[model samples]
Target chain A: MQKTWNNKAWFLVLPVLLLVAFSAVIPLMTVVNYSVQDTFGNNEFFWNGTDWFTEILHSDRFWDALVRNLSFSVIILAIEIPLGIVIALNMPKKGVGVSVCLVLMALPLLIPWNVVGTIWQVFGRVDIGLLGHTLEALGINYNYTQDPFAAWITVIVMDVWHWTSLVVLLCYAGLVSIPDAYYQAAKIDGASRWSVFRYIQLPKMKRVLLIAVLLRFMDSFMIYTEPFVVTGGGPGNSTTFLSIDLVKMAVGQFDLGPAAAMSIIYFLIILLLSWVFYTVMTQSDAEA
Target chain B: MARIDLDHIRHAYGAKPTRESDYALKEVHHSWNDGGAYALLGPSGCGKTTLLNIISGLLHPSEGRILFNGKDVTNLSTQERNIAQVFQFPVIYDTMTVYDNLAFPLRNRHVPEAEVNRRVNEILDMTGLSDMARRRARGLTADQKQKISLGRGLVRNDVNAILFDEPLTVIDPHMKWVLRSQLKRLHRQFGFTMVYVTHDQTEALTFADKVVVMYDGQIVQIGTPAELFERPSHTFVGYFIGSPGMNFMEARVDGTSATVGSQSIALAYAPAVGGAQKIELGIRPEFVRLQREGLPVRIGKVEDIGRQRIVRAEFEGKPLAVVVPEGMDIPADPRVQFDTSAINIYADSWRVGSEG
Candidate 1:
């Protein structure tokens, strides 16, 4: 058989390439452009060689925000992954309750980002909020505005309330796909409830748990609007995650070079972490 | 091993079943002996699986009691029944190695690790999976996974009985034969009371000491393969247990003869079918001898199936099949004669015994 090379096929990909360039590549190139150059007043620009990148890397503010983001991601994954699985396990397998439960779980995800933040902002106000008033009436020092610890708790709780449903929904999908035969066989084998969960349910839900963990990690790591609106990065920057800090530097201070450099570094870190997660998970899957 | 007695069991899926029509399993009352191998043979939706589940305690019967060795266990859970069942599709722990999978049932009962190891190794060797013992069950082929499921059941020693529900459905044809034989060998060697459920007649006949033939949520007959072949208690058993099933022809029977169309054939004995609503005479295709002179039949199609030829013919405006040996010549005027010893008389689909 003779093989034919068709160079004309490249024409079909032109629309997608143009779309990606305008949407992603072009904007990214502009950031790269700003990162590698310095600008003065009167539209004068000068070439700067990686100095902004080094400066951002050496700054304590960047490291602190990075640490905060990493810690937040770790904490939420630890809580949400197990919590979601537990909830999904307890969910009704059949009957009228399934749709009702699913809709209720999805309600939190449907709310817009800023609205969630606004709801929590007012809901946690020391003077007027129900939660704050209840806590204060119980003789607890509860003020998100002035106390860094309270602000951190409020932000973490808000993120968990908003994003844990994604995990629950994914785990629910995984749990339901397992056939009833496994459960029947487990019962016949005299497996206890914990053994059933560990051997049958957990292994069945592994793929979805990986997906949930990765999604929660990325989303929580890059979370901005909700925490920004609720805490306003106040209480001495206790809850200022990397995205919040990045927005403050880029949009507030208007330091384009440093901000652009930081953005690239943040993108690289996320890409690297996600790649590590994917490889580790899929490798374990293959081994199993 | 324990004798299992299903005493007047009936099951209905509905919460409140008001009538017999609502029942999934109409009724089942039989006792399976200790160390006996039995097969529940029926077509799909015939309540074979429901009966098996009831026996295994996966589903409690809505009526009647179940006894294991004379102890009432009707209210017992499946776990409390201490029975092992392999499902149609292999249900394996995906993350566990094959060894660990087989050991799981033992470990759950808190069996010591040394005993678990001994039993697991023996089963692994028996199932030809010793080499794959360390391999994850998820990575095995469909047949290997099925072997794992079977091995898990066999590894448990204290189980009252091991029930199989179409466990070889997922295996390849060749592997099905191999696994089925392995199961038979295991049943013989261990003498475990086994109840296997399958719709395939060959599987049922070959694997079980007694085949319980079911139809429309009722047991038509329970007998050995030879007895089922010779004397089916119901027309359904006669129809369901053969390659080309029994031929049933509408007939009018006198004391010692049955009239088919204008020809009256001699019977070995007078069947007591008095006041019967319907009368049918059934004889296997093997017993319908084709010859030069008998009741005249118009030949339709002759199918040569390697060892024998199946002559499809119309006998007095009714379809009939006659099996003839290979290379046998069909006479110019072909007809079929039913072996008098093999003729069975049915009254309203139920077989009629001989008169005193």
Candidate 2:
């Protein structure tokens, strides 16, 4: 069948094309502009092809911040997936309890990221804050401002509280969409409770689980504001993740070329990793 | 291999039932014989599924005990009751292969692997899923998935009965015939006590030895397919069992004879019971004969359905449908005669006497 070659279809796609240009393409062109070009003074620019990229690629500070970012994302994903699914499974399925659980789960998510950072910053003060004071009272050395381990734990815990609800909501949506027939059929089939979850619930929740993972990966990978306010790259850069380091280079030290190069690299890493996750998950979903 | 006795069972979905209208399933005291093929035939929301669930122990009756071969199982869970069920929509483990779907019940019961393999293979062949057994069940079409559901039901030998709740609804019409025949063949081969629920009269009549007709929330009549057709015990059964359904006309009855408007018709039997609030003359289209000289009828329309032509007409001011043989001549003055041996007199919805 020959489809008449009408150029009108591209006209229909013009809005979406313009949207992508504004939000993604135009900004990326600016990053590319800065990445290979150097600006010394007002309106003075010079072509310095790949020099900043090479400097950023070789710098110890860049490598350290990247390692921190990678570890944080991995740890966040590992803790959130299982924990969210467990909470979703245990939440009440019907009546007033469902609304109560949903509202409670959504409460942490509704708070602004900066506000979360401020709340945590004050809440972790060893002199007056409840958590820090309690830890000190318990004869434990706990301080996010001064201790690397404590800072990491505090950041991870805060992230889980802020974002685990998104996963819980996604998984819960998956769970309720399953018709009552499957459970009844399993009961008649003499399936154990664990078998029911393994065979029926998990299989049904696969698609939603993919979305949850991807969303969490993208959000956690690009995380900045909360940790920036809470630790301010903290107690001699122990918790200085990639975003904080990029801000320091760009805004703090005004190293425009290196910061721009590093930001482009960071964007590419997120895109590549997200694409990999989507391809692997959807491929397995298609197979099953 | 068990006789299921629903001993005075009643169910109400509300917290505290106050009246009969509140009940999902009204008091049902009935039993299904071992190895018998039965159909719970009714329109939608007629409590057929509720009854099936009760028998399977997915639901417990509010009023009475249920017994399987005289062993009380009303309080037991569906797993403890040891029955098999096929749902309206196919419910197979999507992540598993077709073979694994069939073997699931057996594996859950911890049956030996060799025995499970043999039974699964046999069911695969029986359901015509042998070639697709290695394929994942998630990718099968609706009818194919339903066949896996049937196979799972058949894999368990220890199950007391297999209950089907309109399992062929999602199947295409052509596949529906094939799957239904396969089901009938299975019932004959293994003689597993099977109770099928369906709103389609053709499916119920063709699939079961006995058809239990239900209306609202109560069973109107329970009889063999032949009995249901020839002598429906209730007006609802008479109206529901036939292809075009039984034609009912307002009438007055008095001992073997019934008067419909101005014309008198002889009944198959005399009613020993007293007169009731309503009396109706019931006769299937098969029993209403079109003739040259009888009570005059105004011919309306004729629908040719392959071998038979159903003539829609008006007899004595009431609408009527009489099926005639194809190529039969329509008389100039068309009139009709009701077969005396087939005429039924119903009083207050119940057929007073059908023995004659």
Candidate 3:
């Protein structure tokens, strides 16, 4: 009741507060505002609480895109996490080969995402491209433009090519930080190769694996630019991830309400799943 | 248990090791009796760990061979050599329980579940980790995790020898004593041939029946702790073994007397100093007694260290230390007498003749 008020203190934090409001809070609030309302023409809006949300939840197009997003993320994680670990493990631990390998691993990561999409789009053309023509020359039916499965495969491979290096770099960082003593001790313990990986390498890499899983999951789920540039969500919506569908709904069809609502849902899904992934991965660390 | 022999073992980290200086370990020829405990004591980068790694088969020697009970195991892997090693920092499987960590070595060889259980339980009990057997090994204190590391080695009954490379460095001082005594007890209880490597002299002297003192990548002397204190085979051993270590002075020898500057001290044996480029007198601080009469010395400082008073002095322009028991009188004009029985003469850093 006797507390003195010094209003000048607010001035100290005003810049950061305004910065956050403009960059993050404002955009997020705009999405939330649009999510629960109907907007039409110049500055006209109507209260439509939860209607857009229900519409988005009920749409088949949304569900299919969601399923596609989930499947793509799962498949990529299943392949890339283990594959990245294998590659990192096999990479030279020292000598001149180390820098060479590091530079090569970083190469794919340095290319712009759209450039990656463009590279694969041109490279997968059956008539002119090396890979496509080589496959055709090998008597295989490979046409990414015409077949849905081929398009999905092309997109998956493209994503893997573009982003597996992130996983490799992270895992390599985790691997190299491990002191040499663990390996020496494992060797002295008569541990098999599998046991060493399981008991030493895997446990040591847990933190990085968490970041890897979260990054790969979130990035792959919200993937838009690369596949959009490459397939344009063609072959009858086979590769239309949530981000692509959201873009189509908002920009192509001019359906702002559903897109904004879906955007909120998408953000929530990422936040929720990331929490789950983080908790599941890091729970043992807390116990330890 | 099997006796282990290292035959002229030498190792160099670099491939093009043409000079003696290039070798990380130089010509270590030694043997460990079956069921004996030995410690390799040396300064950091003096190749104690390199020699330990070689014995554990983690490093193959550049020259020479290793034998286990007369069987050549020079090229064998550590697993094949049946060795267990604990590292400087405790190396526990961070995700595994203490029991499972202890059981790892035995399980790796596909030991029967019952036997593995029996052995794991025995080791857990022996290491006093039975209370924490179910806890994660990674979550325990450093010393507890080290106990698990030790248990993993001890769990395997078939190992040729178990080696420790400064395994107690991460442990707290009080726990270091607990673990050292535990190790000593384990050595007595199981009679496992052990080779411990450390820079700590107290640990070496207390843990090993014979301490192998190394200097400059070479084992200079291997002897009982008493022999190392009484007569160091090399000047390095004398300098590295005791609390403040042995005090050595540049000297000249003739008959039974060794002359340091203008002071002549009687020696136990007359070392033949023929053709020797350098001659030195080595004596432990414990043997240098301060009395009212003898060679003149100027007392510099007296340090009271609980049970012993280390009298620092200068004799013939050379600094010396004398360890006098607590409550021992220090004369206002203090001079010193070197224990004639304990005085060792060194020529060119090596012991003169066979008195060592």
Candidate 4:
């Protein structure tokens, strides 16, 4: 029997397309308009073609922030992936303990982003917070607000605590899916624990780890909430990342043309990096 | 090739088993000769896989020792045991090429590069995967992936014993047959001590020289294929080993005669019944002869299975199956005669000694 072709499915997606166009496209067009033109009060506007883009492309602030974002993403990925895998390996595979461990790891992830920042802000205080108080009692001058190194450390640690669970979860799923037979086979082959992890567990976790890296990179690069709340891009702007600076330019100084151009450039950078990650990781699978 | 001795081995997953009933594997003690192919045959939840794991050093027996070539290995890990295993489903590195997968174990042991390549190629050729060696294992069909798993197990000749845990369960029917025959050939050529585990009777019967039939976590019988078929030590063996299983009829033994219901049939041997416990007569469908003149039976239905016919009927109100040769006319009046010497008597679900 010949099947009837249904065109009604397109109708289901029309609303989503309209919603995206209204919410995303119109704002993007407004940004594009701002990017190419300068506006004063009373709706007076002057055409400024490619000037803001050229200025952003040549700015040291933009370059420094881009470098900072790249480095942070790389460092976070380097620390999180291996740490996640190790923790996942040590986790109980079944029974009551599994649920407890899962809940514990998931606790940090469930907290709101703003709450996470607030909690860290208080917790890292030199006088009131437990961590800072303990470090002071130990005679260490640990103040995140005043020290660039402290700010960087706190940000990295916070990112690790909040996001490492994602990697652990993905790795755990990969680990659990492995049949007992592979371990048996590994045992029969007299494989060392390291070899088993390297050959079997690591390879099996490739696809999940790829996802973890991409997600962590994207989030770390675009991080604005926690660090902004904690540092306020302060202490001589030492902790000022791209998002903080973007907000500073767009909202603090109200530099519309330059900020819009900067925002577009930032979006393009993230898009390009995410696309690279996806392409490189999936290329081998596609080729095979 | 090495002789493996299991000395009073027992295992439990948790704490010490307080009773014989508490153990998953209840005191298995057997020694398999070098180069002899054996199969651990049992249904799921019967602890066959547990026993295999213990033998492979994946699990330590709570009681007794495992000896490989008269040396104790009870404290060894699976790696130290030098045993290879193939699992039920394929356990291959999906991202690696088939060649790399087969070569991984060899490289781990620091085998020379040229030698690794030579042996890998030989194994790939043997497994009929030479054409797909360079291809990644992820895209291969299930059967092909399983073949890679099998090849990984068989690649290293230095291992003491190769254990298979229902490895062919996921394989296609035709591939199962081909792989079984190929494995049999590999075992013969290399003289490896191979122990295959499967719940399927056909695979167990066809692949191994000796079949160890287990039930409820105990090894009920270990014998050659013929011995298991012709003379089963336990009622479970008789029931589990054959298709259509062994026909059992509740019986009462008196001197040289056995009575089924109200009909008394003469027995070749007399079994002593000490108590009012139940007694049964066990016979295969193949041995129960259908005739025109004998004990009357109510015919139920006939199943024509190509070369033979299975006459499903009731004898003396007890279900009985009789295998009749094809092309033989079904008599309007159907009767069955038990081959006297082929009869087995059981007491309380166990075979009893009866003088023949």
List DockQ, one per candidate, in order: 0.85, 0.86, 0.82, 0.63
User: Candidate 4: interface RMSD in Å?
Assistant: 1.7
Off by over 4 Å in 4: A1-11, A126-143, B19-21
Model 4, position B308, has a per-residue lDDT of 93
Q: How many backbone clashes does every candidate have?
A: 0, 0, 0, 1
DockQ of 3: 0.82
lDDT of 3: 0.90
- What tier of docking accuracy does candidate 3 attain? high
Residue lDDT tens for model 4, A126-180: 9899988898899998899998888888888998999999899989999998887
Model 3 lDDT, residue B173, Cα: 94
Which candidate has the top score in lDDT? 1
lDDT of 1 by residue, B165-270 (tens): 9999988888878888988898888899999999999999989999999998888899999999999989989998897999999999999999988889999999
Decoy 3 TM-score against native: 0.96
Q: How well is each residue in B1-356 modelled by candidate 3, as lDDT tens digits? A: 78999899999999989999999988889999999999999999999989889989888899999999999999888888888888888889988899999888888899999999998989887788898889887768878888888788788877788899998998889888988998898889889999999999999999999999999988899899999988899988888888888888999888888899998898777687777899999888998889998989998998999999998889899999999999889998888888898888888988876333
lDDT of 3 by residue, A1-288 (tens): 899999999999999999999999999999999888887789899999999999999999989999999999999999899999999999999999999999999999999999999999989999998888999999989998889998999999998898899999999999999999889998998889999899899988989988999999989988999989989997889888999999999999988889999999999999999999888778867886
Best by TM-score: 1
| List of clashing residue pairs for candidate 3 | none
TM-score of chain B of 4: 0.96
How large an RMSD does model 2 have? 1.9
The C-alpha interface RMSD of every prediction is 0.7, 0.6, 1.1, 1.7
What is candidate 2's CAPRI-style docking category based on DockQ?
A: high
